[model samples]
Target: MATDRLGLYVHIPYCVRKCNYCDFCSLPNGGAQVPEAYVDRIIDEILSYSGRVSTPVDTVYFGGGTPSLLSSTQMARIVYTIRKSLNISPHSEWTLEVNPGTLTKEKVDAFFNLGFNRVSLGLQSIHENEMKTLGRIHTFDEFISSYNMLRDAGFGNISVDLMYGIPHQTLASFKKTLDTVISLSPEHISVYGLIVEEGTPFYQWRESLPLPTLDEECDMYELAGRQLAVAGYEHYEISNYARDSYRSRHNSLYWRFGEYIGVGAAAHSFFAGQRYFNTDNVDDYIASSGISVTQTPESECDLEYEYAMLGLRLKEGISLSDYESLFGHSFIDGKEQIISRLEEAGLLTLDGDRLALTEHGFYLSNSILVEIL
Candidate 1:
């Protein structure tokens, strides 16, 4: 199943209002009113890949600006088209990314009915002030309501997104957020450290903002790992936690360097040994029927390096024997000294044939990776 399976990502570039800290491709005013023509373009793109993709799609992710903003009818049409045009497996994990205020009970039921078995809710923090600082449109109560609606609709798999290193966010406040989210007991959790990207409003106001210090941010990250582990969640990836088999299959595919096709504006894809992305402009994507902005075939060296880089993100790390089979050389062929040095530093570990980062090494992964690679 792992050999030839594919993942599908549908990007909905519509949001009620862009967050101050976000630099992702999205239109602030488009969520409230997604044009039918845009939806049709997505459908057409899916159809275009019908006969080309030989593998069965095992995972489908509807990521967004806010995918929950689509009307029930529009969502249904897209789902219908995917099933009709693609070799989607019956047991595929279909995930929809939603914002609190964007969901309703009817929409929740419709999502489940349309085969979206997993939902990733974006609720960065519960504190009203912190929410405002992040430019979120929903209140804490609204998020609770949305979660309740999803559960009431019989949706068992849910993932909540949390953020740290926020402006004026204290350790105590972040601890409370973790406590509150833990109490809800979602199937999966993702904790991300806020990055003030260059084009975002946060970047413009960076000098005046009271962001948590680097030490405090590190503390928050450590606290999350400790608390989540105690709460019976596995730190499966650098920023993701899951209970049992609840890990995000869609995301896991990417970390494995598996093939996937992305549809819609600004979506990226890796298939046929090539990597490409659609234009960010919605109108341009619609007119071109999802023409790629750029398409480049990846070299064997690129894939080997990519495999090593992405595999390192997982807690299980990369399999040296498997790497040899794929690349016709040992991953540690010429880097024995560097690997030994890192192992001595206790930053990395070689257990049997699998090479992985130690618990402490995860914190310094970027630097460790730079040194090794």
Candidate 2:
């Protein structure tokens, strides 16, 4: 097995109902039902990469339009196929994204038995009205029930998804959601502000919605960070907070610029200084002769800018040593003026050997990063 770490991401592009705010490549639950034949095609794709990428995989994440929709037998088959075909590490953190409406006791046990140690539940909000407004099938009670079931099913390393900045979301409502989440005390929490994508229904009606102001959104983010921190969760990455030893190792790989292979429809991967993505259409993905790797158009300058933008999202920020090792040059020499300006504005901090963003900086992080890049 190679010493270099790798990650495997499997995208299941099926959802019961398309959320208004979502634009990820996913089909309506009933429109494109996931058949066993589809699963076999994905397994074939996984096998194709066995000899191509020789590194040992440290993480395997089943992200989706609800990976929980798959039956235990189906999930076990996928996990088993990967284990047989790849050099999967014994202690790899295998995670599956589950929706509140889809989880069951049997499915949870099967996932645990098949070596899925981490579960990310899509409990977007604990408010029933908000859930309905967001077109979520699961009610608040159902989410709580699913959560309790996961706990009862012996899952300790769990992460819950929460959304802020909805159409009518007030600070008080957001705070209540945060308080409810804190009380549950999952090992990890991913708090995301709503982003209305171009093709989504939310975007069509965005102008009519009473969206939170930019400042209010920032306040909500900072407040959530402070509250989660107070509850013993470390605000490790942007939108991610975790208790000690429970950070999302798989996602951290993306921000840290580690290599990973993405399998299934619309999945993206970065490896060997190159980035590529599979075709987004499910039919196209299943019909393709084999694994298709489309090389992305990116320049060295583009990569550098991306590195800084992504790395800065972490609370620990970017390290000079790692930056130099990867790029074969010193960050200080090329970006002195830009860094100085950001630091002077109090948006960034330059410690001994690391550069990190301030809490205030995170709100305007994208703009600040663009300026620096």
Candidate 3:
């Protein structure tokens, strides 16, 4: 049986520059600010969790504002500490996120030598103008260079991120982006539709710009999915497409409602039937003597809703059997009427024991899920 193991996430909150559409917890580059002290604090936090839980870690992910910005030595030190502090399995998937400009051959080699088996590169688009519009500092040439360097470094498992529906992006431009991405043939590709979050530069500029309509965005999504499928990528999630054997193990943990522990500023964790987040302030996080009390765990109702939302995002949807196993009741007992209604509308399909969304339903998944849940 596959054990109900926990994954580990470490957030690196420093970035050389903040993107126009980003609202993630990150700080822009100031002066010479090294993450050494912050790494020490996180090591302490990990040690605090020792002996409190017995589950072995199967995955470790280093996500960030730009984790590649850290010196290779710094990264190695953090990885060493994590290995020492946790009961991590030898074959666990260890992933690190890298921005295009910061990935160098030396850095890539160092990360590989330190046992990072996966590297997720941020290559938002291949168009220089589009990159500029998104406030990205790297150009297409720089991204390609970084990619080649990683390949030269002998890293086999690589993932790349792309964005669609940006300002001035048309079907043709989006298709070109997809073509560029497919040509690279990454093991995994995460395509996201740009959402204008409040307080971000894109959101503030929304009034002056003509954003893509919802229908146009949906059309773009469908086109991308079709193209990716033709290239032998599985549309495993709403926004993720991966080649066989390349699906992100760490992200799958989130979609499957598995437990994970997150470290660093603004990191979130779900463990022991509880969900919580760390402080977003880097200075405060590093200054704390112990696990900061700023974390807030979720209520039981919130967890239920999260399970429904996350599971619905996957192509497999949620298993009725798994729902009963977790909640101690048949999923259909309470939602039979709703399921039947949705089935009538051709939004959901029930093939004996399995339940999933139909092709049309996936595009309107949110509305369908709200009705069912």
Candidate 4:
């Protein structure tokens, strides 16, 4: 939980099939690639950090198109490399993002043996029609099977991801999805609003798709917060909810502006007051050993803006004292009128030194942030 510690993010940019709405840097038909070569490249990238990054890594997150697609042996290779090359803490929270139908009992056991204590399952919906419309390869039954496999293997920390505002998705269907997932009682739940990114199939078909209107999406978001709270899950972030002590530690680092190092194709890093990212082209990453292309340094003013912006995503919001100490100026210096107006509208809460969004504010966080920042 300490901000001084580092987090490692390993990106696996391959998937069985690209979802219609996905625009992330990933290659479909990943099974056709030589797994061993990609795994070796990732290991090499990890070793490249040896002796350079000395901060103890307390969290490791395997995120991607589908990290569970890798063979257990392949995953083990990367895990071992990280342990050997980095100051990896023994109690680190290692999480793997898995898709249903890509896991088995043996694989689950292997992941546990490799020191993974958390598993994030991607289950967008429970309805057959919705899953089909989303281009998800797994059935609701497959997700249940995968969840059970993790539980049976003694993995207590599990997070299930759900989405609202999908094509042809309705409030009733989303509520059913929430009910079914809550019944499972996973340690954490993430409800995301769908974004139709440019260049994605959804963008091309935007007019024809039966996507939820802005009002409908807002309704679904409210429904999630209400139901998840009743189910004993804390809405810790804008989209993330968790039971006691189950908030995602790895992701928390990001919101807190803590330093982290990312490895693999299209991965990003925020460390030593600089932000940089690797090339999105997987083939180029393999050839270049996942070299990072650093960007221009952000101005001190830029840093201050970012720190407050990212911190406000948390329910805890920003500590005014800390912000002033870090930037040597009051966060409210120029934004008093804006903050006062937001508070009067019940969109923001200013409790002494802490400033955070109200539930309503979180729903319109983008516009609110634009005004404040």
Candidate 5:
């Protein structure tokens, strides 16, 4: 019998150059070539999970610093190892996160042949000044070149990554970026408002930065939804929009509270009522016999809270039956008063067994979820 479906997240924590706003587990190329043993080590890690993990793979996401740093032969070897060692479903959706100036026709063709059906390109903005302020390595011209090459390489499913609220960004610039992306008609679009976190250059200079005013930021975000909807894209998730069935299956698994296996540095996984993440130290992960993993304790309340928080991210919201089945209790019974209040305030909607936020509630989701969940 076939095993249950599982999502697999593979982390490639290497970037040609780290962006100013980035805090992901990755580092600059540092003028050194990629480690020769990188392929073997990752393959070894994959094989180590063989008998330990019982589920078959439904979706595989190669997220990064920049997975495009891997050469075609290296990617092929790693992919081949995954197929050889795991029970990958025939209908699996494999996605690779790439950046501009790092991909070419041959590299993407290799990925296409290896069964990678989706590509999420990092295109933060189309304006040159914004790109420079964000410390991105490539220009809009470079993104165009990379994008065209991927299309030529027969990639039908592509997701563009965009950002707003960058220093000196304006609503007009955001529109140009949005309109340009819409013109390309990619399968998906992910737009995030910039957040300056600690330990980053942006954080240090945040006070003096000419970042968007709170009101302007809100307008930019609101405008994103309106423009994207006009372009025939479904605002499926808070930060994501898709056309037809091109929604990201791997990401959907997370929002649904489904199980997944994460391999590589700083990769987090939740499966079988437990949560864990591998060490963030790349050198340590490479040299150790066994990776140091941290198991986070999740109490019953924590799980329920997490479910509600994550489910609220989707436009479809949470299903009553599904919630009850997972937690063995009625979600409505637990939060009827709060639901009634939110509904009265026009921030929430109840469609039979489903509970989701309204279009207005989308921008206020963080506050609403904090209150309800």
Candidate 6:
């Protein structure tokens, strides 16, 4: 079943407004309306891979630009097209990424009515000044209102996104944001550290921004682990925390090196041992029917390294048996010395058949992964 299952990701490339720190492929809304024909193009792309998908899709994620920007009717049309064109499992985990101020009661109801089971809300920060600096259109109040609206619309699985290391974000302020989010008891929480990516407004002003000190940023990450643990949320991945069994299954597919199809402008796909992404240009994507992107074939070595890198991001890490069975090579080969060294430093844990990172190791994951890879 694991080998035959499929995951679907649909990218909605339009946003109500773009954030200052974002470098993701997205366009801000002007006076122009969202292209209704874009859904048709996405459907066309899905059917292009018709021969490869032998089993029903297990998950569907409507990632954004702001999927919430679509009207209920528009979203429903796309959802309907996906099911009509593909073999979707009856128990599929369908999720949409929504921004706070963009959600409407009608859209929320449409999502629930259409069988979308999860909503990942973008509530970057609750602090007013921080929100403005980040160029987010929604306020803390708006986030709360949108959240309540989702609940009323019958979304039991919701994830709240929070940011740390924000400009002028003090420890006290970050703690308060976390506390507020925890009080609401959303099914999942995604805590991320701020980064000034190139081509963004924050990058140009990075030198002058009053961002937290390196020490302070580290402190915030550590604090998040401690606080979330006390609140009964599992630190399942480096940037993700979930309560009970609410871990993101679609995302888990990615970490497990499972195959998936991504459709839309700037979307990426990994299937049948190849990886490719659609063109970043919206016009090109639409005109070309989403086939203008380059596809790269992966070598056996590249896949092995990818599995190690991605698997190490999880709390359970890599299963030695799975690695050997899949690749016909032991993951411990030649890397035992480095792994043993990391274990001695308390950055990694060798628990019988799995090689996982300790909590401290997760914080230094980038460096550790580089060393191993």
* Strongest candidate by lDDT: 1
* Candidate 3 whole-model C-alpha lDDT, 0 to 1: 0.84
Q: Model 6 shows how many backbone clashes? A: 0
- Candidate 5, residue 69: Cα displacement in angstroms equals 0.2
TM-score against native, each model: 0.97, 0.96, 0.94, 0.97, 0.96, 0.96
Candidate 6 lDDT, tens digit per residue, 98-179?
Answer: 8888876877887899999999999878899999999998899999999999999899999999999999999999999999
Weakest 10 consecutive residues of candidate 2 by summed lDDT: 29-38
Candidate 1 global CA lDDT score? 0.91
lDDT of each: 0.91, 0.86, 0.84, 0.90, 0.87, 0.89
Could you give candidate 4's per-residue lDDT for residues 88-169 as a string of tens digits? 8878999999999888889899999999999999998999888898888889999999999999999999999999999888
Better of 1 and 2 by TM-score: 1
C-alpha RMSD values across all candidates: 1.6, 1.9, 2.0, 1.6, 1.9, 1.6
Ranking by lDDT: 1, 4, 6, 5, 2, 3
| lDDT score, candidate 3, position 67 | 82
* Candidate 1 residue pairs that clash: none
TM-score of predicted model 3?
0.94
Tens-place lDDT digits, model 5, residues 278-356: 8888888787544357899878889888888899889999998988888899888877889899999998999999999
Higher-scoring candidate on lDDT, 1 or 3:
1
In candidate 5, which residue ranges exceed 4 Å CA deviation?
1-3, 30-32
TM-score, cand. 6 vs. native: 0.96
